[model samples]
Target: MEKMTLSSKTREAQSPTEKWMRYLGFPGGILLFLLILFLPPGAGLSASAQSGAACFALALVWWVTEPFPTYVTSLVLMFLLLVTRTSNAKAIMDVLGMEVIWLNLLAFILSSMLVKTRLAKRMALWLVVRFGHKATWALLAFLVLQLVLAPLIPATAARCVMTLPLMIVVATIYGSTEATPNAFGKNLMLLNLACISVLSSITMTGSSANLIAVGLIQNMGGHRVYYMDWMRVGAPVAILTMVLMWILGQKLLFRMKPGEQVPQVEGGLDLVRRQYEAMGPLGFQEKKAIAIFGLVLFLWMTDIFHMRWFGVEISAPFAALLGAVIVLFPRWGILSWAEADIPWHLLIFSAGAYAGGLALDDTGAAEWGVRMLFGGMNLKGVPFGLTYTVVVSVMMYSHLLTTSKTVRTLIMIPIIISLAKALGWNPLSLALPAALCIDWVVGLPISGKPNVVLFSTNQFTVSDNFKYGMMTCTIGVLILVLSGATWFHWLGITPSFWAVAP
Candidate 1:
């Protein structure tokens, strides 16, 4: 009995390092748990700040771990925030109407119909079959398709979920596994999928974070990132990145044998075509969805210019809500309420994220954080362009931590802008594109919701994700820096980049 008791005690007393290693990958959850256990007294924050920090940690843990349904976790966090005064009840209530969240919900419904109708499947299979049997061509087709689909779809998860199953099917057909082909093909396919996904933010409607970035840019820096403006600057970068991906992806990730025959996928395109055909002449629901989506796009693109009738200006959020309502017109016999199948969990997550942002604003956390950060790393007498370049570069590379890219961007833009201005720089020149592309460096599945959806399939392992992620991040940093320098120069703000201190 004594020996048994001693053994039990020994087992219970494991080192902190050992426990930390077990949970290292889930930093968001671990960080939150630590904060809850040890709230610093007089941390120079209001009660709201403390409550926000706790809720932020809880929401983040749930988001990263996903032990409960994501929406449920989000709601719990939002509830905690409201009850604890982390956010005012009114502001917390307002999080529901956040344009990006509603847009994603509507987009998900349309995506569901596309899935049910097998339209997305048919499209992917068509690309695979048309590309002959080469792996490179297959990847290229997927990349091009994602780029084209991003502007229209508006939600990265919808895009990824639509395409990922098809990619898995293709990978399975090729017999690519972690152990097979020296882990080459598996890594390549996963990496390519991840790399292309970043392009989702190139358009205003592609990802929620991009929308948030647009709003923050306007609010913080007085610069509005219009839809066309984003496309104009972003399209070029996306095109160049895709080209580089083809080259590096093949060389670094996977090397296909020259004579390796691509396996024949049985009933591949035929199955997809047949399934789509089964939908049998588009229903009124699909037509209505098409019309609503088309109208939203038309209004957003043109509404910026024309607002004459009753002075009725159409905001993006309002337009999305309008489309969402039209989706469920009982009289029109369009989509049913049950058929919408919205991911309410994501909306909950949005509420928690927005609550955190509100907490920062309410408690002056953003301002306080900016001051401390500047005090610690004060770059003296640096050229404004050089300082801007360094700050933007760091911000872009810091996305390996969180799952919600929207939350990450929202957190960074406010702090970064505050810091940039204190350092004697025009914050917009440094902050605008940084706000836009910070989430683009998401190299892991947990870096964004799109990534999680893509990772759900057993196509890639965590190691596979990290190996490819590191390379992609390296490439991203270089591209962002060079592009920023070039774009600034083109805009007549020639940058004199300071050499990094050893």
Candidate 2:
């Protein structure tokens, strides 16, 4: 098998045509920006707003085409905003320290502790050993393991890396070698990737993209989505989707042989046991990391309780930071600064993106764009149920076009929020559901990091993934739409469709 780097797997091979497109992307973006900037001032947009609009156009082109690294584009965005006087240096710098950025940083630290202590691997092995006697049970074991680690790990790529080897071992145990694939191997890899993507949407800290969505919503003056709040709305959809995928895999996609129904592998359970035992006993450091993470989760979930009794409200970032501090405190700490796998590039990208968003909002560019795009649609008169359904569906299937979940969130959430304000509807009603769909990056091998990792296994082809992915993506969209009409209504996210005057 050929060994490819992570970057090589995630990035597609560029054709000569694509190379030309990349070359033209930057100049085209600048031209578009200049055109927008010099256009006649209509729709009540001021000169500064026009400049912001121009900056956004150029940023969008750079973001979508990758004339440079996305993080570089982000830095360029901040610089452009400053040069144009669309935003001041203090404002641009201030966005770098926003609560969202801190939450992401602390989450990275916590995740680093998990990776360093090897607790994540231990938990996965333990689960597979206990419940993986049957093919169906084995699949469910992986799904449940991912769900358990989603909040704690935060990074989808890291979790995928931790589980990929185990998945390969399981496939080999079932006699499904990459050279000779079978129903079980195909289903196992595809379903594992799908479940990881879906589970990421269930918690705010589940993925960086989720946090980006939440930050964008908060920037738009909507109510903050806390850990509990996201779980309340996203949990049902996530769980239902997982169950649906399991049914699809077992019944329709992968047909198990009669002998394969039971754990027929000569030493399937033994493999897991040996791996589990290799770690030896749980070390003191692992125990300390576990305790600190538990305390953080408790504080995050019970913020309201602490606020009422102690008159001190602890934000999610602060709680996470507190846990991270305890983990790095010299005497009791488990992780060292050198061991931290923090993606500094992502943080830099996020800072610039946040600054761009802030400039758009401040210069009224977001509002202007919203009016220009949706003002004539009379979307305000459409029933909330129908509108919500369409928006969620669009967001879910958008993965077919682009591979970057963070970029998708960056582009979609702000537009949805602006649309909500234009239509006189609660921004959360539209933005939350759309943001929740940010993690639905399962339609292609390039859709997300997990997909890339799983695809490299050679257990399945592109066609296999597309067939299963399209089916699952469609089902996921339907679940979100149905929930928006009923479940979300009960939670005060989706309004009564018929109650409003058309």
Candidate 3:
């Protein structure tokens, strides 16, 4: 058939390296599973625990390499876990019903309300019209846009898609195109790329991965992470990380030339203004969308105060459900079930990862692995500062290896919690700080969905992305380590300096 021929041509068009990596992914996963399954059961795990570890190792390999779609890989992992007797079918199914998964589902439905009503697009245009005259302010405008949209739109790719056309217009205004790229385009696209992910750390509802990390703390670490508790720690850290990234990125990483410092096209600003004017004024849909989302956000922000005022608390999922109900309520609602734009594949992917993570916890595999690994590292006498730094650094940089933030959280948080247990330290000390770093997936084009969406413009090279991302990540690590010592200690998240763990 013609479709088969087109598929063959597409495969032929790939680079040799891409072809090899893709072809090798399946065998690579199998090899890892077999290798780990047969590893000597030392003092760490029982036979079932070893099997659980093997399943996890295989999932990690396939997730990173992605032999199939990530969700399909997750499905395979779930079946393998049940087949290998690592977990039961009922428990695996139960993860899909968890509050975290419900939150993600409802978040996307609410996100669709914004997209359908064009509210997200409207906000982006207004900001650009207000502050997009100069190159410097234009970059900052998009950064601020990301911060505003992160909490509202749980999907980063959706946010990137909404703003991508705007990025192109701004890039063209500065005389850069796919054919004629310049530092201005580089800075504009890269800043949006980083901000879209980095700013997600600011709020607990910003990304599904943040919710996953928080859920793990309650389910695995046995402590609830209130929204404000997360906000108190993550807000300052994520904001500082974004501020430093913007400064260092514009000044040192991608310095603009004199000619490229200002808008090169005379009528480009008018074009953006006209685009905003084309929509005329805010319609009934936009206002209703705003009102519904406003209620959702107010409930989320006031969760800690809800018990005192209302006699009971509105959980994150229920608050989102309240808005979703309005968005889907017959003729009054904006979108129908088919138009909500929920990504069932991604939800399934999270469910699989969640199932795998909980399976490891239930079977004692995560603890056994952490003990065997950290016991050999001799972390007992090390200062808490050193351990915190190492854990945070590992979580921050681990995004470069794996493409999925959910995978990183599911695999790493449980291990970090177990490590905290083994080291006689508070789980939140290591887990919460590391969870804040989960959304900083800005290194490579493949690092995140948002990165891929922006990189499609071909405005910036991989090297440019690498340069800015590495610099920003380094700055981020230093900022976090500094926070761990001072701000975090003051907030009682991490212990004071000069204190060694027993």
Best by lDDT: 3
Among these predictions, the greatest TM-score belongs to 3
**Alpha-carbon shift of residue 290 in model 1 (angstroms):** 4.7
- Candidate 3: list runs displaced more than 4 Å: 1-15, 132-139, 142-238, 246-269, 379-475, 480-502
Candidate 2, residues 53-149, lDDT tens digits: the string is 7886787676655577656877898898888889989999998787656765676677667767767657656655777667788888888878887
TM-score between candidate 2 and the true structure: 0.59
Cα error, residue 1 of model 1, in Å, equals 59
Candidate numbers, best lDDT first, in rank order: 3, 2, 1
lDDT of 2: 0.73
Model 1 Cα lDDT, one tens digit per residue, 347-450: 55555555555565566554445344445676757655466656655665566434346556777788777766666556566666676565474465445555
TM-score to true structure, per model = 0.62, 0.59, 0.64
| Cα RMSD (angstroms) for every candidate in the order listed | 9.7, 8.8, 7.9
Candidate 3 lDDT over 406-486, as tens digits, reads: 767887899899988888888989999989999998887657766654654657755578778887788888989999999
Candidate 1 local distance difference test against the native: 0.57
Between which residue pairs do clashes occur in model 1?
71-345
Itemize residue pairs with steric clashes in candidate 3: none
